[model samples]
Structures are given as structure tokens and as C-alpha cells.
Target: MLRGIVEQEGISKEKLEARQAQIQEEASKRFFESASQKASSLETMTLKSPALKSRRRVLDDYDSIALERILGTSDLFPISYLQIGLNAGQSICRIQIRDARGRSLGYGTGFLVADNILMTNNHVLDSLETALDSIAEFNYQDDENFMPCPTHTFRLDPEQFFITDKDLDFTLVAVKDNPSSEKQPTDFGHLQLIPTAGKILEGEYVSIIQHPKGGPKSVTVRENKVSSIFDDFIHYLTDTEPGSSGSPVFNDQWVVVALHHSGVPDPNKKNAWVGNEGIRISAISTYISENYVSYSATEQRILTKVFPNLKPGPSSSSQADGYDKSFLGSNYIVELPKLSEEMENDVSRMEDNNYVLDYTHFSIVMCRSRCLAYFTAVNIDGNQAVNIKRSGDSWKFDPRIPESVQYGNDLYAKNDLDRGHLVRRLDPVWGDKAQQANDDTFVFTNSSPQHKNLNQKIWLDLENYIMQNAINHNLKVTVFTGPVFRSDDMVYRGKFRIPAEFWKVAVMVRDDGKISATAYLQTQKNMIDNLEFAYGEYKTYQVPVTSIEDITGLDFGNLYLHDPIKDRETIGHVIVAPEHIKL
Candidate 1:
């Protein structure tokens, strides 16, 4: 149960205004104090001998010149400026979010900083599931003479990649490549991330081209300036509106410096706006650098561009990446199911892996026995694009996980068992990096041994049916799957141990915010016991989701109450067919 809101003493409007004014005054005083010190030093130097004073003035001029070089000159609209805006426009995108009926829900903005990767505010796109129906329109602007601009549209790729941080108010996603056309290419002429801090200075002129109120793109070329820089935020005097939530805040060189999120009221009594608050690009780079794993050379190169200092190896934990369980709608952590004390013994929870794979829709926890807990998502996109084709990437042990803990190919040799995907190969294949996701499913940690019939027939169909039919349940579904380890498991030629039964618990978030879940168990008892060279007979059952909690000792986080068979007395006995699913 949620606790009531904490009540604090409220201050009068006058007191609130006074406190805000004081804060502004203090900040202004600090800036001026430094300026005053510089002025005093210059005055003191001027009082010296003429030659020495002139020498001091020369040094000051040199300092000004150096500052100009770093911040870029405001003296003239240089040729570089035109190229900057042009390239930025190609990268900038207008985000339009809509509801189920195709009516407009709202709009925001975003920009591509690297290949197929776009950055925006978390509030704009809380998750790829929500972003599925949201359209990302590129080059949605007016021409030089205010003529209609050519544009391209790309869908959000939830299956490929998605990561977001709420404290930073930023979301990074990989969008589909644009098709071949006269309008645009797959690549958006992107801006390289600022390599480090001090790239954007306070009071420096910053540019922002955005679709305000979902209108055509408008640029704040001459009107915007960086007001302040905080640990995670950059306050800038950029003109924005309701539809500009995720617009990129760029420096004069067209380098993306921040993501404009919300406007703040001025402290003065004029009742005017001061500046907008934005999540710093550095914060974004740091988060993505630490949390998300790159799949291919292209993604690796882009990751290097966005996070130049990122090391080659994987991070220790998402917590090491400044993880907050509450952020991203508590997407990071997979809560252990509510189980009795007897269920807690001997269960080891694992999350860290070589993939840096704790993302919006999925995370993997491999046990010491080589099998894993795979948490994956199914949403509206998953329902449509469930047909993502597979590639022939060779299965390999993930370097980040202990090599000894994985079931390698040696286990399948000279046996009736088949190497199966615990997370299901088709489940993660959605979005821009669909190929990469397909490749990821081939990792050894995600594989288990299954009877050929179980892999090809009942088990496969059970998952396929749920993913397809659960479309009615809002498509924002999360699933957990793994093999159930028992002491009497089959020993494969003394090299590997294969379990007879495997379990899957699928939790779907209904349109009304309630969870709907179904637990399934598949066993190959008949096939493995026969010891004959024939196809195995497999049985798949729909068990109560709570039953898994007792056996796995992991919590499913409010998903138990949602089990369709939770209240049924015949649970674990009543079998469900694809057409007869309770969904």
C-alpha cells in the first residue's frame, strides 16, 4: 500500500516569491563577484606604469580571443553557421504521440546524435511501448522561403533498443532506418556528442530548432543563451512550447549540448519566462554509455561517438551506472516473487552480465547451473513485428558471464536434446537493431537443452500464441522464463545436466493498468525416458503463476494477482489451447 503524501508547512505566495528572488540574487551575486574581481585586477594593473598596463591589456585581449575560439564568435553569422543549422535540421525530429484511435495525444521533439540513435526526454517517451505509436518526423520544417519541407517518418524500435533515465529526464532510442527515397537517407546527419564539460559555457549563444506546439520547425538562432549548468540540468533561455519537450539544445557549432524539457517561471514580478530546463547531454552520454550494450561494429562506433570515454568492457552493475529502481517505471529491477521462507534457500539472484543488457523491456539473470531467468517484453510493436527474421550468428558464451556457468555446444553433442533459447529467439527481434537482438538471443547464457518436439511443437506454440493473442491486453507485456532445476535432472554423458521441466511466467499490463499473467510449464518426460530414436512426446501445462513463486523463490511484483488461473481450483490441471486462451 502506498503511503499518503507527506505534508509540510506551506508558505504564503509572498514568502515563496521572496525565497525565489533571494536565490536568484545570490546566484547573480556570485557571478558578478567573479567579474568584479577581474575588473578590480584590471584597474589595479592599469594604475601601473604605462608599458606594463598596456602589456596587461594585451593579455586580457588574448584571453578574450581564446574564449571566443572555444565558444565560437558571435561577431558574424559565419559560413560555418549555415552548415551547422543544415546538418542539425537533418538530425532533428518532430515527435507526435497518438492514442489507439489515431487521434493526437500530444507532441514533443528529439534528435539523432548517432547512427539510427535518437535522444529525447523521458516525459516525452517513457518507454518504447508508449513510443510504438508515436511518429518521429524528420525534416518537418519550412524551406528558406517558408515553403513546405520534405520529410521522412520512422517508427520507434522497441525490439532493438530502448533506455531511459527519469532523474535526468532523458530517453535514448534506436529508430528504424528511412527507406530509399528522394527525401532523405537512412542516416541522419548527426552531431557528435560534446566530448566533455566546458564545451558549453554559461551566457554562450545556443541554438535550438524545434516544432513548437507541433507546428513547423522554428529556430532560436539569435534569441537563446545558456543560463546555468547543474549536475544533470542545463537551464537555457530557449524559446520552446508544449511540443518542444525533447528538442536538442545546440551550441553555435551545432554540437548538441542539452535536451530542452520544461520551462521555468522567472523569479521577478514581471510574470515572464526565465529559461527552460534541459537534461545535459553529458548526463545522457554517461547513462547510455554505462547501461546499454552495443551489438555490432556500427553500434560500437556510434557508442564511441556518443560516449567517447566509455571503456571497452562491460560495467559492473546498473547501480554502478547510477541506477534508481524507481526510474523508468521500475523497469531496471525484476522483483523476486513473494515466496515463503522455505522457498528462499539455495536460490541465487544474478543480474550482472556481459551484455550491459538491463534495458526498458528486458534483463537476464543467469544461474550457476547455466540456465537463466530471462525477463522480456511484448508490446504493440511486438504483436505486429513478431515476424522478425533470424540470422545465423554462431552461439557463443557471453564473455561477461563466467564461462564455466554457461552450457556450451559440447552439451548437445551425441544427444537427443536440442539447444533451445530460454528467451525465445523471436521475442527480442523488434526495432532498428532487430538483427542485433536476434544475434543476442544466440548467447550461451540464454540457451537451454530441450527435447526436439518440445522445442518445435508445444513450447514454441505456447509462447507464440500468447504473444499473438495478448494484443488485446495493451501489448505492454513482460515475461519471465527459465528452466526448473531439480536434483534428479538428466545427466548428459557426465558433461551436462538437463532439466525435465522448464517454466515461463508471462505478465501483461492491461489497458486499465491491471496485470494479466499466465504461468506455463513444459516437460519432456515421455521422450527422455524412452531412450529410443524417435521424436519426443512433450506436454505443456498452464499452471497458476503463484506456483512458480514457490518453486523459483523470485517475486513477480504484483503480477501474481493478475494470473488468469489464480482463483481457479483446477489450476495446473486445466490445459489451454491457443484459441481458448483466457486473454
Candidate 2:
């Protein structure tokens, strides 16, 4: 295959030979430099060591023993190394490359690079059509008792994301979501490809996890020595077969170093292999970053997940002065809702008498008495929205407010309660400041304690529907969300009050230039009990904007006039599906 690629590219034999020699020399220089650094460090350590004042034994073998102590004879690894390697091997899968008719074309190896994203050789999955037709079979190996393990198959979703480079011989595509599968793709954790160098040094051993000859998953453990290094490729003396094309070449720490693609044939002999070559992970990352502009927002978002280092961090100049009223445009101005005099007295305010707390793309007005946001407002630009993956739940307290007032992890630590985001994490995530906007949503000020069942089901679905609506129409939307605080709300943990009902109001300008405001209400009143969530049916409703204002004692200016359901006699319409949504 290497010869075939060389011939197809019309590369002269002389050029290949010269390139090989240059890479070999570079590898040798790197190895020597590394060795010199190690020796220098050892010498410094010896000079700093305390002198042995009382040496009782002075034997002939003492000098050799001391030398051995300074310079280690063998490489040592921890007992956990095997366990880590085994865990990493689970991500490896056999790729069954087939045609549209389900006829087998061939087979190769691939692995999860991110959640629902697989990485393989470009030659194995050359085009979008090829990837779409292929399927990834996980757990395609024998069990501990040498019995065949049940495999989980997942189809590739090239329509969602697909990128490849013929020169790099690498392809990255998304795997279709398989919620009903016995094992999820996320169950076998991904091998994050770090863009930085120094993962492995020259002359170090690399392990290849592969499915050789279209067979069960196998690993050649630390047997391949890196022989040469180039700008975009590395040569290793690794034993691999035809079906090992897309195997992940890993270092001792189970970090992926390269993507094994083809073998380097022995020049002196025919039908013999000298070493295997892999595309450097760093090179692939660089290529993707450089060509990021060509991809769609969805693809770019996925790329950012696969290469998090490429995602831009929050800018130092990013100053948020609360949600913008004119974010929808000059013609359509949606001012902040006015707080009633009685509600205003209980609202948390700064020294300047400003109640709105500024974040990246959102603002919050906390209720001083309830210790929860009276309302949170966010500006959503659907076109520029970046889908930043949630790293973890790290709810924090806003430093501007007293920590004693805001609820932390205590309320949701042991119960079925969820710290639901008032301003959804993905709402304000757009433009160059997406990551910062995402981080800003994690503050405790923006969260409300709700039943897990309510937060994860209809409420989440409604949020997705709203976002998708904005995206589909290529419009900007301003959203206001908060709990419907009532005097009779259930009290939990002796001090904190858990609101049973949550409401969201979204305002957007239609393509026809008319402003549209819609309100939604979800209740968990029956679900929340004394200290736990009892089984109960949770319902979401499309309500009139006037109803929200009446319940919360807040004036939303002229938003009620633009309500899609305001003219209707119904106060609340049950939203069972996406079609049930008014706007």
C-alpha cells in the first residue's frame, strides 16, 4: 500500500530515499539530545546529594552498585500500567467497511476520539459515502474465558461530521447515537488526541491496539520501537496486518501518539516489511484548525470538542454588562421585565442599586430573601452558536454575592434534586466568546433546585426545541427564565425553599419582521416532597405571557401584546410534543 501510494502520487524513488534518510538522522539527533538532558539532570542530582559520613562497607563491587543507582539499567513501570492499557483497549473497535447493499468491502480498526466521534485511516474510510455505509463493532474480542463477547454495532453518521486528509491518511467522523444499545459509545472512553508534542520520545516503545486480518481485537504491547520521525509521520518497527490500518499507536501511558496507516517496506528485499508508519496526531490537528473556516457551525463545534485546545478561551476584554435589550435589532426592543415594588424590596442589588448581575452573555437578578435568581435573561444568537460539550458539573458561587446567601452543592448532593440552569448552558454560547459564556452559566446564582425527572425530560426537550427554532430561522432570541416563587412553596433542608414551578419567556423577530413572544411553564409541584422526589407526572404548558406577569408580579413591557397565544381564551395549553409548541 505504501508503494502504491508513492506510485499514485508520482513520487520519484530518489526523493523517497532522501526523505527517509533525513527523517532517520533527525530521529537519531533527538534521541541523543534526550539522553544528554537525562545525564545532565542525574549529574546535578548527584552533586546535590548529601555526603555519606559513615560508610561501613567498602567492597570492590560498591562502585558498580553506586553507578547502577545513578543510571537505571531497566525501565520500570507501575503495576497499574496493565490495567490502564486494558481500559484503553476497550475503545478500539473493528470497522466493517461495506457498500450500500451491505456487501463487505474489507475491514480495518478505529477508535473513539470523542463522544460519538470515531477516528480511522482515510484509506479505510475514504469518503462520506464509505463512512455512511460502514459500521463500527465494539467488544469484538474474546472474553476472559476465551469465549466470544457480545458485540455492539453502531453506524457512522457522516452527515453530522466528517473530515479527512489523503496526505495525512486520517479520517474523523461522527458515530450515530445509539441510546438503546447494550453499551454506549461513551462507555468505552475516548482517547483524546493532544495537539502538543513530547508525548513520546525517539527510541521509545509504542503499543498498537488493532483488529488484525479482520479478526478479534488484539494489542501488540510496547513491542514497537520508534525508529524515525518526520514532520507529519513517524516510523516504528511494529508488527501489524492488513486490518490494522487505523489502529491507535499509543505510548506507555496509554496516550495516543499516532494513527497507524501503512508499512515501510524493506528496500533490499521484496515482499518484506522493515517498519510501520503512522500519521502524527499533531499534524492532523494543525490541518483541522487551519481549515476550520470551511466547515459548518455544527462541524466546527464537533471539531472544537475533538480538539479542545483549538477552542478559543475567554477574552480578557470580554465585559458583560447584562443581557442586551436590542439584541434582536433596533426595530424590536425587548426591555427587561419590571419588578413589582414588593418584589423589588426583596431583590438583591449592588451598591449602585443595580439588580442585574452581569455574566458573559446573560444577566441574573437574585431574590435576596429566597437566595435564588428572581429571573435570568440571556441573548441567544443561533447562527453563531457553538456547541461546547459539558466537561463536568462544577456549580460555583458568584463572588459578587455573599457565599452564605447562594445555595451550593449541599441541596442536591444526596437527593433527587438537580441544580437546573435558568439560562441554559448552550443558550448564550455563540461567536468567539462561546467558552466563556458556557463557563458563566455554571454559577449557583443561575441555578434553581428542581426534580431530576422534570429537568431531564420535558423541560430539556423544550429548551432544545426553542434553540432549534432559533437556529432554523437564523434569528436571535432573548430568553427570560426563573422559578415562580410563591409564599406557599415547599421548604427543604430547613432553610432553602424549593420552587415547584419554572417559567421561560422567549422573544424573537420573525423573518416577516414581526416580533413574537412565547411563554412556557413546567411544574414539579407533585414530584417534590419533604426531602425527596416522589414519582409523579410532570407537565409542560404553553401559557400566555400575561399569565407569567400576573403570577410573578413583573411587567414585561409590551411583550404580552406580541404573545402568540394571548388572544386565545386558554390560559395554559399542554405541550406534549414539539408540534404542541405555539411558536
* CA lDDT, every model vs. true structure: 0.61, 0.77
> How much is 476 displaced in model 2, in angstroms?
0.7
**lDDT at 158, model 2:** 79
Worst 10 residues of 1 by lDDT: 1-10
lDDT of 1 at 48: 42
Candidate with top lDDT is 2
TM-score of 1: 0.47
Clashing pairs in 2: none
lDDT of 1 by residue, 1-583 (tens): 0011112243233432343354345434433334334322212332344433332331224234433433344355556568758776878888887544555667788888666777777667665555666778988888879897877888777556566665676776777765654544246676667634445655566778888988888888847666566666666676777678888887655667787877665556464665677777766666555533434323444566656665434432223311123321454333534433443332234344243234223455555543443332322234434465554435655545556767787777776677787777766555554544555566666678787778888778877776665444326445668777677776766656667788887755555656567888887767776434745456778888878766656567766676878888875853446764564
Off by over 4 Å in 1: 1-77, 177-187, 222-224, 267-271, 293-309, 312-583
Candidate 2, 343: how far from true, in Å? Answer: 1.6
